[model samples]
Target chain A: MSSFAPVLHSEWLKIRSVRSQCLALAAVLVSTTAFSVLMCATLSAEDTSEAGFDPVRASFFGLNFGQIAAICFGSLAVAGEYRNGAVLVSLTAVPRRGLFYTAKLTVVGLLALAVGLLTSATCFVLGQAALGDLGVGIGEPGALRSVVGCGVYLALITLFAAGLAAVLRSAPAVMGFLIPFLLMLSFVLGDVSEGGGWVDFLPDRAGQQILLQNPDGPLNPWTGTGVLVLWVAAALWVGGRRLMRRDA
Target chain B: MTSIDVTQLTKEYGGRRAVDGLTFTVRPGKVTGFLGPNGAGKSTTMRLVLGLDRPTSGTATIGGRPYAEIDEPLRHVGALLDAQAAVGSRTGRDHLRILAATARIPARRVDDVLEQAGIASAADRRIKTYSLGMRQRLGIAAALLGDPEVVMLDEPSNGLDPEGIIWIRRHVRQLAAEGRAVLVSSHLMSETASFADHLVVLGKGRLLADTGMREFIEEWTTPRVRLRTTDDVRLSAVLAEKGFHPVADDDGRWTVEGARVEDIGPLTAEAGIPILELAGEEPSLEHAYLALTAGEAEYTAPRPTAAVQEV
Candidate 1:
């Protein structure tokens, strides 16, 4: 078996070598921060004090747009392998399919996490500044958890899309399915169903709960993130099995 | 010297056998030419050997272990199955760097292979901009990066120009001279004849011939005598009476199969058949390959009318 470290290094090189992947990473930071600050600046003090308004969630509004770039980063990193048959070269070099898959996800997950944390923290600070007197402090109740959880959420969603990309083996297909399911289908399903019920358990919906200061659903922030983790685990498992059983 | 040994390997896709009970060994210090028409399972066999695809039955091993079982398999065996199998957006140098990092190969080796492959000037360019010939050279550079004991290249000459072709022929020979086992597949019999010491011929996913290059041509092709006679009809009749089947060329020359020049010359002289020219024709590798794979080709184009009479 090949050692894990060198494989990790190689996977890292693969991700950074491509211009689109790097740009996607930058997009995650820029789009999320820019949109979050914009939302904070436009909101009035009247809305911040409202009982139903979640200031933390409002501050992280850019995540809605930023996650799309995160999805692109994850999917392109894996799906690019299938684009020109690079997977064949990859598998031949490693030969151990499990190790290769793990290393790849590890690199992608870590990179996304690093960028996610930076973006999350930056968006929070800037967004609060834009909100002026209405803004909440980082030390306030649930404020710290929301910020950290927001980063973890982005990382999880990135891995979630990457795992699906592995199974789908096409960038367009993965993006086509994931973008609608996260952006529209989950919302549509939530609106149609009363009391949230099982609809609250959807990966993106549950995961986004980590960004909310006051939880409306039955699940807490950590547990909501747990639901997304379960979804990610399932995707990665199926993707790994397919990679092993199928010929490159 | 490590060698590749395949035993009764078989691979079937959707109940159709792509490689059927194939067996061959590539020994060190020789270039083995893998010859077959398209869809003859050459690529499939190479894939199985490299562990890119699983064989349905039997085994393909390098240095006494399966490819996956060997730690750092690239250090033991290097293979290039497809030249175009790369991310087009990555520069050629970055592409090789990724592989080198995987195998723990030194970084300098990437530059070394780039220079060796004659693509160093274009090493930093995206592969999408590369010509097919340049891509082929990049592929070869990657295969040699490990400097393994065994090297397998499939259709290495596919997109090469005449100079590239000549360069690869010499490079392949040099690899064999260095005592490494090399297996190169090509449908061009002429190209194979130029570099390969041994031949492994496949037809419709079955092993048709596996022998030394000279022995293969000698065994599959028959000797023939070509003669231009002043009296073509009389010479044809005399050859027919002697139990020799003669074919007449459009050039008015007569060819007799399985006949020696020594025997034909004296026989026609004694029979008083006036012959303007008589000589023995050396059997070509193309003829031998065509004869061996005559009916086994899955795809064949119809012969043109103008060329039919030359046979």
Candidate 2:
């Protein structure tokens, strides 16, 4: 087998070389932090002190928007190969379908993790500043967890989209299906079922639990994130099988 | 030297055979022209050989190993299946650099191939902004980056200008001269005739002919004799009586099919016919290709008269 380091390096070069992909990565940070600040600025101190209010969750409100850019970044990394027949060239170089798919997803996951960490930290710091006196400190119970969980959440969502993109083989198709499912379907299911039952297992709804201070869902914060991880593993498994069996 | 060996290779898509039990060898130190009409499986065969597509049966090997089994196959075989295969959002240089990195080729080799392909000036430009000709050059540059033993190019001259076409011919020849196995696929017979030392022709996903370039043309077409005699009337009657079907032209020249120059010269001398001009015409590669692939075209236009009548 070829060395994994070179394949990883090559996949990284592929992502870094494309301007649109870099822009998408930047959008992840900008959208998440900007939205978090906006939400934090508009909230009142009285609301923060409310009986059921969760300031840690409130700080990550921008994650909803930032995940979209993260999704784009992930999908573009994989689907870009299908576009313009780039996959053929990629497969030609690597030859081993498994190796190519693993290296590509590894690069996407790592980049998303790095960017997700930066975005989460920025959103937390700026979001607390915007909240002023109502803000929670990092040392506060569940505050650090939310900040770190927010990064992991973004990376998982990105990989989820990437895995789907590999199966669909088109960025637009992956985006069209994932964005609506993340923004509306999961929330609608949660609202209709009153945040209980099977809807709690839905990827976005379940994963977002880590950012919350209160435990309302049946699954805890870690368990909820584990549910999302299962979804990601499933997606990656199906995507890898498709890549191995299909023609480039 | 590494060479491609395809034996009984077959690929079927949804019960439709794209490549049907095709077998051929591409040896080193020669340019083998892969000729076929559209949808005749030229690209499919190349894909299978490169391991882009899984063959339904049999095997395609480079140097006795499957393409997928070879470590860093780009260092063994370089291929240009499509000129537009590179991501358009990246610069030309970045595209080659990515491939070079994957194959562990030196970074400087990327610039070397760019200059060799004659696209160094536009290496920094986004590939989306490049013209078709420039994209072709970039694709060629990517193929040569690894400097592999076997080179496979499918329709490499598709969008090239006349100069670019000539350059590709010379470049292909040079690769073969350096003892690399070069298989160039094209639908244009004349283009293949210009540089190929061997020929592999396909018809309807089946091997139609596999032989040397000269032998293939000679085997498919019969030689003809053309004579312009001083006594046209007597010469024509004598040739007809001797069981030769001579096609007379308005320019006073007669053409006889399946007749050699020596055969005609002896007959004319015995008849005391004064010949102004008598010469043997070599069979054309275009004619041989057309004849071999006559009914094998997957998509052919209807005749003009037939279309007019139907309308």
Model 2 Cα shift for residue A5 (angstroms) = 1.4
lDDT of each: 0.91, 0.90
Q: What is the DockQ of each candidate?
A: 0.75, 0.77
Over the stretch A1-248, how does candidate 1's per-residue lDDT look in tens digits? 33888899999999999999999999999999999999999987687778898777888999989999999999999999999798989988999999999999999999999999999999999998998877889988898998999899889989988999999998788889998988888878888997769889988989988888788897888899999999999999988899999998
Q: What is the lDDT of residue A172 in candidate 1?
A: 82
Question: Using TM-score as the measure, which candidate wins?
Answer: 2
- Once fitted onto the true fold, the runs of candidate 2 whose alpha carbons sit more than 4 angstroms away are B233-247, B262-274, B294-311
* lDDT (Cα, 0-100) at B45 in candidate 2: 98
Model 2 chain B: lowest-lDDT 10 consecutive positions:
B293-302
How much is A45 displaced in model 2, in angstroms? Answer: 2.9
**Ten-residue stretch with the least lDDT total in model 1 chain B:** B294-303
lDDT of 2 by residue, B10-78 (tens): 999999999999999999999999998889999999999988999999899999999988887778888
